[model samples]
Target: MSVLSAKFGHRICGLKDGRLRDIKTSSSNVRNMEELEAERAAQKIEYAAQVKMEQRIHNKLKIVKQQFNSILQSWHHSMHQLRGKVPGFV
Candidate 1:
């Protein structure tokens, strides 16, 4: 009778071992999914920040270009006045 009980206990443990391994694998998969989600969120935040920085740089460059064009126009007008004052200056 004792020998039969020991065999039965061993069989139960064997079945439980397979179930335990499956549970551990499932837990590991959940952890990996969570890590991937966190990484994706971080990447999104970084991309937003980069886009904002690019927009700021573009706006600043536009302002600088406008100022440069204004200065060039002023210089051109001054040159035209000087040319008019000179005799036979093409």
Candidate 2:
């Protein structure tokens, strides 16, 4: 027979026990669904936080690169001045 038919018959034959067990299983199923939904929401929040952190890191890297380029340009200018002072510097 089908599972439902068996459960129904069991409910009739074992009255109190079968009914209580079925109710407990149903309640647990609801709890499991709620817990799964909560976990999904938490995961989404964590993913958003990680994305924000990556954006911050990217901005910081861009700033650092700009600073390095500026420093290099300054050094080049100073070297050109020193070379100009030397006699016969190519």
- In angstroms, how far off is 8's CA in candidate 2? 22
Give TM-scores for every candidate, taking all chains together and pairing residue i with residue i.
0.66, 0.65
lDDT per residue for candidate 1 within 60-79, as digits (tens), equals 99999999999999999988
lDDT of 2 by residue, 1-90 (tens): 112332312321234435422222355665676799899999999999999999999999999999999999999998899889987765
The parts of candidate 2 lying over 4 Å away from their true place are 1-25, 87-90
User: What's the lDDT for all of these models?
Assistant: 0.68, 0.70
| Model 2 TM-score, 2 decimals | 0.65
Error of 1 at 2 (Å): 49
